[model samples]
Target chain A: MENKLKRKMLWLDAWDIEEQEAWFSHMSLQGWKLIGISKWMAEFEKCEPQKVNYRCDVFKLNDKSENNRIEFYKQSGWEHIATRGFIQVFRDMKGDNSLEIHTDPIEQAATLSILKQDITKRGILTLLLSVITLMLIVGAHQIDPVGNYLNDKFIETIVLIIAYMSISITMVNGMIHMSKLMKRLKSGSLLEHEKSYHRKIKRNKVVGITVIFILSLWVLTVFLNLMNSLQEDRFPAIPKTELPIVQMADFIDDFTYIDEEGLSYFKENSSFLVPRQYQLEQMVEVPGETWEDNSDIYSPSISSFGYEVRSEWLAKKFVQDLKEKHTYYAENYVKVPESKFDELWLSQGNFNAAFIARKHNKVYRVLYYGKGSIDEIIERALAKAER
Target chain B: MANDQRAPMTEAMYYVLLALYNPLHGYAVMDEVKKVSNGRIIMGPGTLYGILKRMQQENFIVLDELDGRRKIYHITENGREALKHEHQRLTCMVDDGKPLLGNGDSNGK
Candidate 1:
């Protein structure tokens, strides 16, 4: 008959040797005998339900005397089952008169020194990684706080911080627990092999499930946002419904919407920080208008971005960022005092004019490359923001 | 400095060195130690392995032969000298204790 096999995730830490031994023995009584072990899992084979004694020992890896050690244990009636890292598992019949792996507590403590050093090294590595992660997070925010918030990268940053913190905390907790176990062993106390592990197992299971759930949710949200962006139609006809943005029709009369390649489109997006955002780019030509009575057409263009932010403070910051960004190329932006909006700035270059305005929790920026007055465009934008 | 490092041998190390005097395999050494200590010192396989490895590193023991997976070991001259020193220290301790304890009789009680 074919052997039936089963696999189980190992939630216990490597230093929890006694708890592991007891758990393995309990599984054996339920007819599952351990056959293989790894860093994350244990594989078992079906067997008759019988009492068995399981033991775990730490041994140095890559030792030339490893085979001799195994042979000696075999001679002592204990069968070696598996090894994960420095920890080895062995078993024997419960009724058999087999000697324990470490009869002297002090000698057992000597064996644990290797594992203790390993944990200390891992703790240091975890700390280093955590510091790097924190620095990256802070640097991202410091570079461009408004851009980071607007692009919805703050969600990814928060998730990464939480994940790193969870892993670092777990590593530190494991290190401390291992140190306590070493101290007990050094004090000449024998490790108890039948201690109950149900409470710890249950608590770890809950925490593990919660972390997995949160990660899955984050992945799903990112995937859905990617799908939405990919499915957006480019250069579609202008909708008849009123939009929360300034359009070319609002400023020009009898202007025809240009439906050619790379000309006109509308995009809508929402994020946790800004619930509603709209972008519009349109190119229009006045009927029967030419630059110099030649084949060349006088096509004027406008690009407008509007955002309904979460709070008035964010709107103020968004408008300030917009003004700062345009000031680099358009020279100094002059504030339009006593405007209809709460705050406004007008920037003009040789051929193009732009304005950024904010009122309450709404902010909008418009760039017009046409033969139109900048004050007129600002009036239309304020009208849209008021609605 | 070397003498200081090798002066105080643990009980497990002393027993293991004594058992290796006859060029015994790993299991045989453990059995010999238990027999010599009269069931008072039960050396676990892990303890014995660690001691053997350390002693070999210190040049206190040498591998005599290899029979498949079984390795036979023998104590070296350095091992003998260290064991003799440890025995003398133990004897001194016992002599000092005997004067006060009265030869392990009911003197303290």
Candidate 2:
């Protein structure tokens, strides 16, 4: 005879002893006898449809007397089916009159003490992890809130927070259920067998599916990041044109675009929160300019980064962020109230002049290293942004 | 004071101790406990195992030998002392109750 097997993914709390036993019994009645069990799955073999009793007991797996204990149960006519962590499942036919594994409720509660202690330890560890995750998020925001928003780290942080909170919630929920089970057993009530598990199964299904969905989302985010890193063009062969970013030619006349190795390039990237990002680093020089004439090798270089955000509000905030970032090099940023763009802030520095501007749903920053009025650079940047 | 931790022995623990008087293995202890209790206390394998392990930890019992996978245990002196005290305590309680309940034979009717 050919033996058939089936596997099921189940999410039953270990402390929910009655529900686990009842569920196994229910499966047996449906002609699927449990053959194996692990943390997240149960393996079943096809058998004749018959009523049977399933019982779960907790015993330390590493105990020296574990084999003796199992042998004792077998002598009493209970067949050990599977062991998952400290939990051991046993089965017997309904009318066999086999000795119950735990006749005394209080004694059974003694066996559950080990499980309770294990859960308490896990609960404490999980709580610590959750607190650390929360602190990381708060620290990241406190250090550079605006920078995180602009660099697309805000979404990743939110996802990490959700993942930790979900795990914490699940752990706390399991602790609560275990406490209830312990209370009942301590009160000398035998754990009910063959109870209805429909509600518990439904609830577990929802929780399991939600956990899987969150895990998949996190994995997808990480995979996409890896792929983007591999596909990013670090050094372009030729200069890109028609880009919606400020270029050196827009501000300088009769300048040669510097195509030096590893000095200048155009790059693009995107994220879920903000799509359509562009970074440009272009160095330009006059026809007669040379390093001998000017100590600086790369003169009149334009390094600009821009983003076409999904909303005007985001662009407004991004412009402020750009200004704050540039304030490190330039002592202060003076607002250009009557600019061609929606908003603009020009850096107040002699060596490296910069301007941050926003128009509708677009935000950009341009840094110039030359001896020219920053107003011309700002005007050209605004013109390009408006176009 | 040495037996303070095991001063108040549970019914199951007391019966298990009594069963270990003859150096019985795990399953044999369960059978003996049921027989000595006149079939009133059908000790489950789980309960028997827990009591045996705890007794061994408290030095109330010692593993005498290992017959295949069966562990035969014998009661220690500490176990005997605890059982003796528990028996005295139970006897005192029954004696005290006899005055109010007519020796537990009149059925209070």
Chain A superposition TM-score per model? 0.87, 0.89
lDDT of 2 by residue, A125-166 (tens): 999989997998879775675556555677667767877887
Error of 1 at A243 (Å): 2.1
Give the clashing residue pairs of candidate 2, or none: none
TM-score of chain A of 1: 0.87
- What candidate 2 gets wrong by more than 4 Å, as runs, is A93-95, A137-151, A237-242, A288-299, A329-331, A336-342, A385-387, B1-6, B20-23, B66-73, B107-109
What is the Å distance of residue A43 in model 2 from its true position?
A: 1.6
Clashes, model 1 = 0
Q: Which pairs of residues have clashing backbones in candidate 1?
A: none
Per-model TM values vs. the true structure: 0.88, 0.87
